[model samples]
Target: MAKFALLIGVSEYQPGLNALPGAVQDIKAMQRVLQHSEMGDFADADMTVLENPPRHVMERAIENLFSNRQKDDLVLFYFSGHGIKDDSGKLYLSTSETSKYQSGELIQTTATAASLIHGMMERSRSRRQVIILDCCFSGAFAEGMKAKDDNTVDIKNQLGGEGRAVLTSSTATQYSFEQEGEDLSVYTRYIVEGIEKGAADTDNDGMISVDELHEYARKKVQEAAPAMKPEIYAVREGFKIKIAKAPVGDPQLEYRKEVEQCVRNGKVSVIGRRILKRRQSELGLSVEVAAQIENEVLEPYRQYQANLREYEEALAEALQHEGTLSQHTREELKRFQQLLQLRDEDIDLIEVPVAIEKDTIKQSEFLYQKSTETLIYKLRHQLVDITSTEIELAEQKEYKDEGLFERFTERAIEAIRLAQEETLRFGHNFIGTEQILLGLIREETGVAAQVLQLKGIKLADTRIEVEKIIGLGSGFVPPELPFTPNAKRVIELSLEEAKTLKHNYVSTGDLLLGCIRLEEGVAVRVLENLGVNLQNLREQVVHTINLSKNKNIQSQ
Candidate 1:
């Protein structure tokens, strides 16, 4: 008892772009196979042949697919045309008449490739869903494109139940091609042709699953163009394609269940709040508590401003007594002035007026200083003793040669950058500890050397150590893998662990404790040799963070 198919072909639009030629061919072939390709009860699909559909109509098509699928059924969604995103990565499906850049804010936003897959996978039924995106910029469209309807790109995590998969024409940045003589897209041509010939079942399992068809289409297209790479990403449980040709039957109840699960209603603001709620457990504070702490810091910051004004006044008075401030004081003042001069980047720090009154009342004193320019930089109200630029510059500067620890970090910065790049590519703003761990493992020198030496541990040797621990026949792949956590936490935990044993900065001891916290790496044995209890070390880090306000050396 195979289920029904939902095939939607989008080629024509009002927004200057014409409907694609191959779209009709693709739609026809898919329609033919879906009705009678295999073990279905021969049900005809309710087809939607849209040409330049309105925004709401396209969104409805996505909503319809997931909302109408069943456990044993296969739901197929196909798209063809031009797609693009703005600077913020919000995707837009052009109407034959729309502008790529200035799409109206009120326009109905379409589902991105990532959102399409993730949403459909949320279904509770055993039904498998397959989506083929045929358009320029269609590859990573679902994953990276923001949820325009929601006003944010941050999608929440919701694992799908069974049978779901996605097959797309190209990666997000690559442009898909259309056949020259025909109206259909080159991508659609191969897919439709493959279905007609029945080469989609690669494993010869008698029936074609979404995964099978996707892999076949991707391979088949390589001959058309050597440079074009098509990709298929399979998610959720297994599924099969049961295509049959008959008049439509009653829509399956299981698809209805899957569709019910895929409804992701609301905006990005709501999604962010949900993420914070889940993360609060690890912080040991409610969202309100974190906000409270932030508010508490403000009053003291204002007080610092008052102190800074007083210091500046006193310094001016002292300068008058001597006829000018000392060279060091002058240099410091000049530093603040320079900061004020180049601050267009952070406009919030434009408070302090450089023309403060002089302590000495000489006639020449007021007229001596000449023209000036204004600049902006973000400054802390509590840091009244220095300009905003100085505060930030101080924060950004690494302490060097302050014992061996400073020297160790000076050399490790580049290695850290490489790891940070990798994390950034995955779309995170900050490099977390897992990246730091990976960085250390990659370099194994300088700061990494210090990290390893604290507990007399070595990463290369530690892999052997891990083999030793699990060698006793507890064959579970160690969960909580290392070098995967956030970099800041890794540094914090590593530093704190080292400090317990009285090490000056991060050392091998820190590295071992890090691996131990991961609870599965061979690096854990080093902690055992150091006579450090894993429970005690973990508790110590908790205590340090709870008691201290800021552990991040590079504080925001």
Candidate 2:
């Protein structure tokens, strides 16, 4: 029986429609498989391809594809383009001339109606007919068919006949997606892959049936784009129609299937690696060959993750400049999405959470501001009153004088407050040792600041070094930020330093010693980066304390 095929791809469209450059590449890919000797085995002379055809040209080619065919002949028609629906939900296959008005109304005359294609299929003499559509709303071709409760069209009841099969890229209500940076559309890419790689041949049969081809493409399309649901419909005997040949018992194909089973979240588990190694030995495949196959299977997943990271980085950078995204920033981010070849759905998954966090931060800041204003007003008007519990606690603390916090002098307390301010200044949500170091340098009246200045370590230089070590934070900053474990350890160590000096109260000098003692803290890293000698700095602080003590004794 003669095999005839006509493939139509419309990459160019009128002003209103977005151009699909992948559509034309899709037709080329399909033609390669159909005319391949070991695949569809269709004669080159009988194969026809039309690229960016106008409405009339596309209509005529489709009509001629189904006309004057023998009953036993195999006839296939494929289209890759925009499939739009009117206000009444009538599906139309868009041609190069297809466009919409300013009101977003579909210009019916510019597109080819699906009804026309269905009519041509009904009048065809060939029983072995195949119709494949890769476009939005392609499943609408099964219109008037009995639909499932979920709105899925029953193609077998409506358009299926003996030896006839229909395949679509998406459901009746879904939009077929085209990935950016890809040469072919997502659905059509898998279709060609199934045929070229002979992966469509299930059950180890030497030939690939139309049913097998549809199932393979459907599974793969969902893997790359979960929202897309490819579909197939066929009547009795149509499911068994052979569309291509396969290399039976191919070891590479078997290995690929094994690799697919072992992969999760784009990685092979430790146990999965062992399983793959055993399979590789059994198949007599070299290690290099096995690794190459595994990489190929993991490529798409890796690309997806890489795209996510890129988008998140860009968003974080934008957030560093402002709490909320500005209109210009939003527009720039949209353009970045296209440049990254990411879909709107994919980016939404990343952006929505960050946006919510920003909103939360704004509310928290508002509350914090109001509370601060109230505190200032009370202090200014002398309206502040100490509660009985607070007074009792203070009396107990002064009597004991054992609590390390109570031992902190007013200057030391100011240093700690300065540390928290430093944390917020850097847009960080948590106070770390780096901020404590900066606080000691900023409290110029304290012994710690005096010693640092003597050693030529200025606050500005320390701030720069700290920034170099820990870049600006991109997340939300709450009203009360907690200190990191290392920062807390520094505070505890400061109390110990005060006791070592036989002092009744903790001083800013003690805080500096605490930071120096915690060698693993980021504060130490910043100090080292600033070319400070920790041992010398410690000695100078001790000597300065001694000089102050001697001066006090002389005055007495």
Candidate 3:
């Protein structure tokens, strides 16, 4: 019996029908195997190859192949092109002329009806008929055939015909795919491998059968294009027609399978090393192709390593502080250490503890639970807030004077130091406005003390009253004590008070005026409790500032 094969592949197509350069390669690969001397062993004269043929030419070729065929002749038809389903659900092998506009009509005219091919194959004189299709939704070719058999149904049971079979690249709902940078479609490549290399002999037989070929191609295609599932349909018990004689094996495929299995299992480093060793060269793959495969697996790992390096560098820089860490820096170190599983040995540059003291009186550390950066920022803002005088409906200019900050009078600086000392003596972690008031009262010869003395507000009595309002706190003195917000506000107001009085240097008089003008705080309440008239206190503080300013002016 003569074996006749017709191969049709379309790479060029009309607009809206994407061109398939792989389709041409697919047909050529299949033709090679079929015409091979010991494989398919079919004569070249018996094979018909068409590239980008029109619809009429394809119809004539199909007719001529099946019409004059003898009963015992074997007819194999293969198509690698675009398979599309119309609105009526009929499948069509799209031609080069297929277009999106009036797609159903265009497909009907330019494409071959898959059902028509099935009908023609059934009516053909030859019972030994095989139709192989490697196109999107090619499984639609066997849509009408159904039987009580499993995936390997006998063709006679489904179509009630002997020696008729169909093999498709993908299921009706699936789109066959082409690998990026590869010349063949995923399904067709495996089909070619099955025919040429004899990997289709799943049962270890000496020949490659149609069922075995489908089994091998389906599995390989699924591995390459996970979304596709190749299918096969057959008639009668003669479905196991040996298409190709089996070669010993394709060692290239064997190595590729191992590499692919490693990739699937996430063994990137192992695969990367293997690829660098040029192990893929055994499979006839070039160094560039191997590198491409390696890069795909290693790209994510490389990114993670890069990020890890940056993280480690940041963590190392944080560890190099001389004194106590800022609460923000401490917390960052803590989180990073946890993430990287960093041990003491990993960061041996410093002998310091990574954690910040949780209950410390240091304002930055104390506010760490709330937010370190915010508290420091707010504190820094107080510098501006304190130095500026507020006027009703007046635009305030931002003053940034580092010199003015360093030019505080010696007595004024001494008073602030005393306030911090008094806070510690009172077993308080924070230096409140009350402590600042005590500092002003205790600076005995300062203009504030002299003014208070004239107003019958003695230092001893004021201290007693201050202590009464604020009882002693727990004696947990931290290494560094920061002023309370109220105290810091009082200091800011003192700077504003000095500016308002036209004094270049802040004094005890400015401190007292700032305390009196401060709307809220224990200082205001204590002065009020002592029945000190705020208007008179303001007058006395302003008069003291004038007297000092005049003395300086006179001395100059």
Candidate 4:
């Protein structure tokens, strides 16, 4: 069967339209896969590429690419550029000749219309037609779309009947995004990666179907750019249309897959070790290998330092303009400030060596140091007493926190903040273990809550039980209540629990387990009174954590 592809990209637009740097890159990436022998296998002559083409050129390319094709022939059309909707609600693909600021009434004339391409694809003799648009409001390419009420099965059934499909980078209203420091747009980056890395083949079938490609790219782009959502509209059941052939026997790519999985699971430390282990297993940890791994680690380390400073500066600005900031923005600034403070402590730990007396838990001590901000950032190995600094350095090896907040997932941070709110609600001067328990309960969607639900425990019942056990506190509540010693210990042990479970983040489950393991807090007493079998409950929590992790992997 004859196969063809028309790849269009516009990186340079007229004065009125903003230029996109990644448009050209997107075109080149797709061209590579479409022409790869193992993938699309389209001959170089069969693939047409238009870079910054004018309105007429783009229209002619689309029309000619789809014209006079056989019923079984596959025709694929992809566009990467700016898509703008006119006042009349007609979507136009901005061309090199299009100047939104100066064209005035000629805007429609200077750009290719989405409806024109849709009409051409619908009318094409080819039974299998695929349109992929990567631009702002690209979803507009799908004409006559009904209300989005169908599931994957329904979409598959419809596509199976029609053999026509349209994929867009984002919804008709949302803007497609580019990565912060990458050369490709967020949507296109994943699209290229999915094809290149064989990740789009969800079933290990060695074939990347249109549906699989869209699903893989959609999930990835959503992860990297949460604001943009990719869409798939199938006119009939071409869902199984083979887009690419998966690669095999590539060990480096396989290892990179592991690294990606670790990232999704929030296993930041595992990333460095994975790199180190891969190097050692493949090349032995020679000087060159160590240097390479160190360079890799150092890039992110330096980036973390830069990011920490940026967050600090933003916090400073927010503080200066505190009166004009919204409550939500102010709260964000506060949380960011705390994160920066935590990062500074991490850097200091790397710079200075601390003496640990009678502590087998080096990680726990690190957390304590981070909480207290033991050394000022400026005091990076520059203490007043050079002799003491020398002695301390001689006594112990250096340590680094390695992106202090990376270990904590977004949910974990929310749980901690909720715990503080619990402390305030109880009118307590300090956060206690009971407050931590309440915080976990209040994190309704947390794994801890899920496990507790299986045991017939509810947040409301737990809150009542907690109040009865703690009794009412005095009306006086401090605005800046610190964690009580027990609470601090619980937090430390929670980190240990996370490490022991081989999980990266200190999850709500870890917090609950930590409180129970402490064995001397009001939290423990409450759980005991409620007739909880601590051992079984802990096991259930671990199981739930694993199940959630697996679910995330499968979804991705």
C-alpha root-mean-square deviation, each candidate: 26.0, 18.6, 26.9, 14.9
Q: What is the TM-score of each candidate against the true structure?
A: 0.37, 0.58, 0.44, 0.51
User: Which 10 consecutive positions of candidate 1 have the poorest summed lDDT?
Assistant: 347-356
TM-score of 1: 0.37
lDDT of 4 by residue, 184-252 (tens): 776787788788778777677788888999998887665434446788887546777888898764544
TM-score of 2: 0.58
> lDDT of candidate 4 vs native?
0.63
lDDT of 1 by residue, 249-342 (tens): 2122222212222323211245544554454454456556644433322322233344345444545555556654578765554444322211
Q: What is the Cα-based lDDT of residue 114 in candidate 1?
A: 46
Please give the distance, in angstroms, between residue 198's alpha carbon in candidate 4 and its true position after superposition.
2.3
TM-score, structure 4 vs. true: 0.51
Candidate 1 error regions (>4 Å): 16-19, 37-42, 45-48, 92-126, 138-162, 236-556
> Poorest 10 consecutive residues of model 4 by lDDT?
142-151
Instruction: For residue 261, give model 4's deviation from the true position in Å.
Output: 4.4
Residue 118 lDDT in model 1? 53
lDDT per residue for candidate 2 within 81-170, as digits (tens), equals 887767765567889899888997789999987778888989999888888888755322121111111123334444566778988887
